[model samples]
Target: MLLSLRGVSKSFGAVHALQDVDLDVLAGKVTALVGDNGAGKSTLVKTVAGTWQPTSGEIFWKDQRTSIRTPRDADALGIATVYQDLALCDNLDIVQNMFLGHERLRFRLLDENAMERAARGTLAELSVTTVRSVRQLVASLSGGQRQSVAVARAVMRDAQLVIMDEPTAALGVSQTAQVLALIRTLADRGIGVLLISHNLNDVFSVADRIAVLYLGRLVHSGDVAGYTPQRVVEIITTGTLATAAT
Candidate 1:
């Protein structure tokens, strides 16, 4: 496994956000984390991304025990997270936005040419061709183009594990399809992906495994091929798979 969360738990003041959540992401596989509102999906993702440390339990990377106490720590360890907002600077061009904080320098001078070349190469590797130029401002790109930029940026940093939150949310049919294809490309390249989404159709389309959380606890986890939509809906609402028998 590239990433694993074992018996992880977290709480915020009076509310318990996660309880003994166990999840695994293997190379070349897309794992979907799904749940209703307040079902601890965000909490779990944050814990793994190092936004919040788990109050209990452990996180393992490549089967070695590790502590991700900071976002920088997670990034250094090859864990990249793309949140709903994508955290892109609209004013910056594609290459600049990709290497925003981790710019490559040659003798104290920013290597703009190197960065631009790398950005273009990465996008090409992902088969992203919608953007006419890497010099184009982010504000001018379409929704799918922006998402591809974010994903390409993450992969460019040698990300072994990528966590995406609502990647296709609020996207049009064509835009969503584009992002979904990029996701598959990521998995095909042997990168572990943890996808958080509410759309079961999208999940079924790309995920190899599905993990459901209910009221801060993981209730069901299995291969997508083994569970029906109705059974998954039941697990999300009731924290049980009893409906699978029917």
Candidate 2:
């Protein structure tokens, strides 16, 4: 496994956001995390992304116990999160946005040419060629192109585990397909991916495994091949797998 959450739990004041959640994400596989609103999906992803520290339990990376205190710590460990917002600066170009905080430097000077070249190479690796040029402003690119840029930025950082929240939430048919293909490509390249999405159609099409969270707890987890859409839906609504087994 590339990453594992063992007995992970978190609380905010008197409310529990997560309760004893156990999840494993393997390298080169897409693990889909599905849950309704307030099912602790976002909390779990936040914990994994180092946005919030777990109140209890442990996180392991490559079988070694690890504690991710901040987002930078997670990034250092090769874990990158692309939330629903995508965090791209619309005013900046692809290369500039990609290397925003971590710009390349040479002899105490910012290396714009080197950064652009690296950004181009990363995008090519993901087979993303729809953009006219990396110099174009992010605000002008299509939705799929913007998403592609965000993903390329993560890849450029040598991310081993990429966590995406609602990647296709508001995209058009073709754009959604494009983003989904990029996700599959990431898994094919030996990257562990945790995808949080409500669209079961997209989930079933791309995920290798499914983990369902309900009321702050992980109620069910298994291979996607063993569960049907109706069964998974039952589990999601009732927080039980008994109906799914039938």
Instruction: List the global CA lDDT of all models.
Output: 0.93, 0.94
Off by over 4 Å in 1: 244-246
Query: How does each model score on TM-score?
Result: 0.97, 0.98
lDDT of candidate 2 over 1-246, digit per residue (tens): 899999999999999999999999999999999998999999999999989999999999999999999999999999999989999999999999999899999998999999999999999999898899999999999888888998989999999999999999979999999999999999999999999999999999999999999999999998999889988888899898674374
lDDT of 1 by residue, 1-246 (tens): 888889999989888899888988898999999999999999898998889999999999999999999999999999999999999999999999999999999998999999999999999999998899999999999999999999999999999999999999979999999999999999999999999999999999999999999999988888899888888888888888664363
In candidate 2, position 245 carries an lDDT of 72
RMSD of each: 1.1, 1.0
Q: Say which candidate scores most in lDDT.
A: 2
Question: What is residue 23's positional error in candidate 2, in angstroms?
Answer: 0.4
**Which residue ranges in model 2 land beyond 4 Å of their true spot?**
244-246
